[model samples]
Target: MTTPGLAGFIASGEDSQTCDVVVAEVLEALGQGFELLPERGAPRGGRRRTWFDTFDWRLYRAGLTLEYAAAHRGGELRLTGASPYGDAVQLVTGWKASRPHQLRDLPDGPIATSVSGVVAPRALLPEVTVTGTTAAYRLLNEDGKTVARLLVEYPAVAAGDVRPLPPRLTITEVRGYLTQARRAARIIAGIPGVWPVTQPLLADALHAIGRYPGDYSNKVAANITGRMPAAEAAATILLRLLDIVEANVPGVLRDIDIEFLHDLRVSVRRSRSALKLFGDALTAPLAAPGTALTGRKLARFAAEFKWVGDLTTPTRDLDVHLLDFEDTVRTLRAAKPDDLEPFRAYLKQRRVREFRLLARGLRSPRFVTLTRDWRERLTAIRDSANAGTAATVRSGQSRRAVVETTGTLAADRTRLAFAKVAKRGAAITPASPHDSLHDLRKRCKELRYALEFFAPLYPADSYGAVLADLKRLQDCLGEFQDTEVQIGEIRALATSMLAADEAPAVTLLAMGEVTAWLAARQQGAREDFERRFAEFAGVDGQRRMAELLRGGAA
Candidate 1:
């Protein structure tokens, strides 16, 4: 009958020309059972409102809406529920016009906490603006207690704003007292042209405009089918990855969140991985003119992506260091967190400088040239596949060796990776050198990327199960390496700080404590490796991965 997430109401009407007389008739139906008391300080006139979402709409998918309106004073900065029917909460903060609310503008409250996790690393892309008049009234019961709220809104699309939902009337039911809300619901239900809002206003806003959030991700699978040629498949995958690299640049440059650089680096890494892991398939000779786009030109593009990746490494590593600084200090048991502030400040300063360097490079013509050249190369590769298929018949070359589908090509690559990982996994023992385990981690990462790139071609049930098990093992390995690396970097940073005489004596103590804690954690990850590895390489895990590689049922 009514819901909370979609702005609770007794009933609603859409697309009907609402007026004072219409509202009066609807109120008359309720009679003396309820009284409408209009708030004295209600805002007048229509205000331009804007809702922000990731390109992919992550918040809405998570049942949250993070909104900010430049033209409204009431609830100008808001986090509301994006669901049609749920107990959605709206947390409000006033909008400061002189300086709009950047991610930092949100105070430490429910809105900030909820949004920080979802929208970080990506700036909020505007979804839509509802420019319309709003008239709100409180519904009171016989005891003079406010039971519900009715809002009559006439929304229109302003010039240049995203247009989707139209103006409407909404009755929001206050929490508790469902009986009173239902009684009120019955009265409004009797009116013609009035109906319940089947869709969330925000959801409708996006859907009507054919837009959604979450435009980018770290694990974006290419839209390649198993039936496509190997080169075509590789190009398809790489092209989408290039788009991810481009999409993340703005966020990275803006420094909206650290995750922007993290994501951009990951896309860069995947490109490098794809080139290395699938180089043979991509470079194989075909019937098309000259060789498929490879050799020096391909190597140059790989070098550029690698260069971008190298630039991002230090800042992201320091970000992780800062993120764990508190927990590291906590591990000291008796140490006051204040002692670590100096070290934390040092890290922040270094990170700011490092990020600025990275951002500058990202905005440079070199980076722009690299992206354009890479896109052009990948596009050329796709065109080669198309040309090869057509020329095979005219040139009298067998399609068998040159034009294999993604299924065979991916299977061969997965086999190569599995063999490497299997060899590495089999060689691991309690007495194995730390270097060996580190090497295995790198090997496992390659296998992980291979599986991810070709996942769509495998049976979901089998592939998903295998990926899950592999992920568990990968997580263990990641922790081991990260801890080891973190411990070293912390110590190195500590040494530099002390050498430069940049930090106080207490900061030295704090650094020692953090280094000790990181060392202990690194050891823990090392000690726990055999168990995690065993689980990952268990008979069942291996069986599922084997099943997936065999192209079992989806």
Candidate 2:
């Protein structure tokens, strides 16, 4: 069956004058099953509009209610299911039918209308029921296909001085009037695009409610608060989804190419990580019937596709190449004019290649798909862990297991950072001093993170010394690295122009100046490193880090 959904925009005036008009229109069209949510003080400035305002209407004939709420803050109008506990199964309307009513021309007069029986649900959609003089209209599309039968009613009319209309024509006349009123309102107050105010997960829950026609309170709650005993069930489902996606990646990549394949891989890894992080929260609500299958399936998939370690290798390699290229440019620029021309062509070609590689690495369609897949997987993992049903003892054990697992991940992250730094540092050619220094700075950052992860586990004295030395190295290297990066860019640009046979003299001149500048910076970095290397590479530094991690002391 098609999903039941609604989409609309709303506008509110500062004085709340337009609010009454909007409400009257809604009441006249959808009936008095709607009520205004209590105003919660002045809205914070520049907040997005939410579906938490104005009138709610219920049509008992269809066992459904449409709750309309508007936020003037961001000019958002939300139309969602009115039932507080269940899914929005009974409401069936296409996108076109779900569009919001536009407010139109306003009379310079006071408007009063009473709407009741629109109470908030403790959870999920609100509870509402249509009441009093109601009328039903066969809503038709431009093609004259019956879209939906809208039942609207007004509360008992008190002594009013307005023109009276026949019962049969009440709703039809009101619909026409509302259509015009909404149009005028729009002219007076322009409508804005739907604002992104809610969390993605919450939005997903709302979507699910609109999509599935079942009791979805638990699902909604799980999504909104990320809390639910049955979260494991959802997470398990998510895991399955990931597996399905991952399984298809190779084939999809074959059709779409390598870029998307790479993205798919990354997505799989991220999804796995996210699930691992929130697994506990997800498994709390699931029963035994499918719980084991869920856990084992996820664990198995993760183990089978465990390639995060492998993927990091390429990332590290690319980083090293980038550093090498930077150093080459710097070195060439600093070289004497006699030595610059030949290297100029080489440097230009290399820079272009590097840029292309970097672009491909980042922008591949596969990568984008993988990223999305990963997000979904993570969500699922969290859901599963939250939903899983285990004995109290088992649950506690799982939590402890998760905590312990974090330590290993921390260690791996640290190791990767150190290794990358060492690799890049070693790859710095004489020609690419600037790129080398940039790599060095990156390495230093990784080292710092590593130290941070191990800090709590290290002895205070040792930790302090290591941190101080690392910091000193970073400070010295940082300055050298910045100059290197700048010089490299300058050298690269010069080389490119000379290679193209354009402005050879000017490019050559600029190249020389940048090269000399880079040489001085490189000399400074090397000298600084030589002086500090003893302290940084000493037993108390490198060896000590190893010893501490191994539960030993320097």
Candidate 3:
């Protein structure tokens, strides 16, 4: 489709001894065979102006133009142009920026020169007439001899088959046209009639050539023709690209910023959605990479890059840690001789670990890679869910049956995964890293709930009790896990500060008290969960529910 925009070129230069050199370079760059128009004199009323008869420059820019007339006077500059949507027309009395009188008064010479043309709007087909005009003015020095020259060109063409033109002009084309007009104006002004020129005509010409359709409009059209499933995909991609440009490469390129990392996450999400929406069009090679990168890789990256995301929370956590550590250090520093050494050692170790974790997270490659991978996995899962839904719908089963079947399958898979996690948890030794064991337990809870979502689809009498029990267990475990995490962080902070040799004795002692209290809290949470699970298991609810479902009871 023809993009609704316009493109053209303009060139202007001063009329001086150096004018020939500039004009020659412009013409060489623009190529040969462009027509030139006859020159004209300055406007009356001491207001200098010039016009061109005819010139042919390339259509390099197209866009809308706005015009306004001077309220005091009837005359105005008629601005005609194009934008992404349609043609533009503007009329104004004054120029955009005023020229210095000293520059304007360089002995009366040609005051202005311009070469302008328009790319036929999309509405015009096959054959369209392109018309342009150019004019020149001469300003005389006080001696009455020509000291400056001005040239302006209005070039218009009546041509057929211009429909084959590109939707927008290239940068090279626009630059060449401007160069030529400037050179040409300089060359013509050397003749006695032209002097005292302004470059406004050149500026106008450049603006005219820079007009063209915007990228958004073109991309939208392309996506529609290409049968993209979601209209938002193009917008999303564009936004993501803009984010990358603005964040990572605001001025100089190289090295990703924290903002860039965040933007990258957003882009991956949108790209994944696009891929799934247009899955039919995407080949395996294109889709497989996304899946492969996600999962384990993404999980690892999230852990490593955890610091950038941690900044807000970290500052707060650090403040609290510092305050407590400082109090403890003060106490330890002023403590009785019996407690001094131990307190000092503890303070020293804590600082080392906290700073180390902070420094490592900021520049970890593994973290970046894992983040990319996780995004890939998320997209893959979303795509798979969509595909699975379609397949189920097409299988000719009743809606209820289809839903039930899919739910059951999903629940079973989750159950199996979580069962493995629970089994692994039992083997976790006291020496095992807290994060590893904690993550495993968390995964178990996720699996349990993933199964519960399908409970309603199963025979109510059969799975109802099981679902309820699973939910109860999940809630208990979730709380327990959270408390555990808090305690870990608290302990890590306390230890780091103690090791730093900076925390006071009082701060160290207080942190120790807090750590002990949290440990007690953890014990209480575990005991509560244990008691609840024991009651659930002994009630025989699972067996009763199973029998009811198997018997086909409502």
Residue-level lDDT of model 3, residues 276-307, one tens digit each, is: 23222222222223432333443443353343
Ranking by TM-score: 1, 2, 3
lDDT at residue 531 of model 3 (Cα atoms): 55
Worst 10 residues of 2 by lDDT: 105-114
Q: Is candidate 1 or candidate 2 better by TM-score?
A: 1
Quote model 2's TM-score: 0.32
Q: What digit string (tens of lDDT, one per residue) describes model 2 on residues 1-554?
A: 11122212232233234534543454343322222221233212222112211121122222443332223322212333334444321221221212232121111111100112232211122221111244344444345443333332222111122221111111121233345333322322232221212322223223423432222111111122111232443353344435544444443323322223334444444445444543443334333333333565456545644543254334333333343444544555334545445444555565456545534543566555554654465564454454342453466655433322333433455555656655665565556545566667756765774454334445677667767877887877876765665566566656666666654564466566656766787678767774464566555566765654554111
Residue 27 in model 3: lDDT: 36
Question: Which of the two candidates, 2 or 3, achieves a greater lDDT against the reference?
Answer: 2
Give candidate 2's error at residue 325 in angstroms.
19
Name the lDDT value of residue 502 in candidate 3. Answer: 57
Name the better of 2 and 3 by TM-score: 2
If ranked by lDDT, best first, what sequence of candidates would result? 1, 2, 3
Q: After TM-score superposition, what is the CA distance of residue 335 in candidate 2 from its true location, in Å?
A: 16
Q: Write down the TM-score of every candidate.
A: 0.79, 0.32, 0.31
For residue 44, model 2's alpha carbon misses the true position, in angstroms, by 21
Model 1 misses residue 157 by how many Å? 4.3
